[model samples]
Target: MSAHVLIPTTSNLPAPRPAPDRSGTPTPGRPNRERGSSPHEGERLRPLSRGQVEDRRQELGDLYAEVSGGGPWAWNEARADFLRHLASDARRPGFSLLIAETTVLTGCAYGFPLIGAGPWRADFGGHVREGLLRRVAPGRLFVVSAIVVPPRVRRENQDRAWNLARRLQRRLLADDGAALGVTLVEARNDGIAETLRSWGWRSAGDGTLTAVPPGSCRVLVLTAGT
Candidate 1:
């Protein structure tokens, strides 16, 4: 993990929180070329809206559970609540959820803009910059709440999971003009943080956490603009 953790210190500065705590990663069959399949082979993509989130809420929850390593109850609760809010126009109007399904539910990338102060501030541990608060207000920042890929996908083709993730991020960049992107990753888990680094996510080196099983989370940032 990075040295600049998000925990509040004497400096009274808080770095980014663990990505909603807990975790995820992905694999699959193939979506077909007409679907403009993945760079590898048969893998198509589908972009969803808040409305779909409302409709597939249960399925979404199940997917997260199937892939994520268990965490503290509080961390789990916060994660659930965050997804609930994103399903509404809660963060409006820049949230995103993309699912990649082939023979099965391969993976997903989901998020919402971190704008305008609200109860959400408490989720990140109240020590962020006024500038960040201002920048995230509505359009300046986007927070990735979840990223998941089923074990089947991971077992069959590891690269495919990342391919789906990259596609999802690309779509987000195409749709949201936000300057920055943020997401949480397990700091000491099995190489998840390292994989993200290869994908261009920069760690803050701070041990900020949003989930329990204490000291296992850290946030990563990506300047998503082309």
Candidate 2:
């Protein structure tokens, strides 16, 4: 969930994928983060409040479907329910959302604290197994839920793109002095993991999560690491 969406574009080249260390733990390193997606010309991003996201749920779902490369009606089939729940959670006290603006919703992401009793705590086996349960506390662990950046506005200006991401991350996290930031990505999407690592994140562990599709996920834990 580093809420980091490592968009794969034709311009991106293949790189080595990270593997678990000898101890079978997620290996941490400055893995090369491949670049592909960026904001197209005349496009900009703005931090959106939970209310804004709820108002634009349909748009977000459509963008998500397109970015996901899903078939027609994928929005209704796959994204509708997910967005509903995400928005609902955003309405809660501690949840947050981020949306990119380009005359419409170009990209978006949302997350919440992992501390206390919440959806994230539905299954804490992954945290317990990794000895991370003790670290979960309000203002401590932030769980990035989902990040979507449609292919429409990708690969525009490298610097601008970086700025957009930085802004979004900044908004998602207030300088609340959280000790660790956590995100879960599908096993197949290791590019996100690598990019998080490049951003001072490391492989914390791997586990099954009840996310959009309920599948295998690798936890990318952000800390003062390579």
Which runs in model 1 stand beyond 4 Å of their true positions? 1-41, 65-93, 122-138, 151-162, 185-191, 205-217
Error of 2 at 197 (Å): 4.6
Off by over 4 Å in 2: 1-45, 128-137, 152-163, 175-177, 188-200, 205-216, 224-226
Model 1 is weakest, by summed lDDT over 10 consecutive residues, at: 1-10
Best candidate, lDDT: 2
**Model 1 lDDT at residue 166:** 56
Report clash pairs, candidate 2.
Answer: 1-183, 1-184, 2-183, 38-154, 38-155
lDDT, candidate 2, 25-114, per-residue tens:
223664322244332434455556666776877777776655655445543555665566565557655676777776676677677776
Span of 10 residues, lowest total lDDT, candidate 2: 16-25
Cα deviation in Å at residue 100, candidate 2? Answer: 1.6
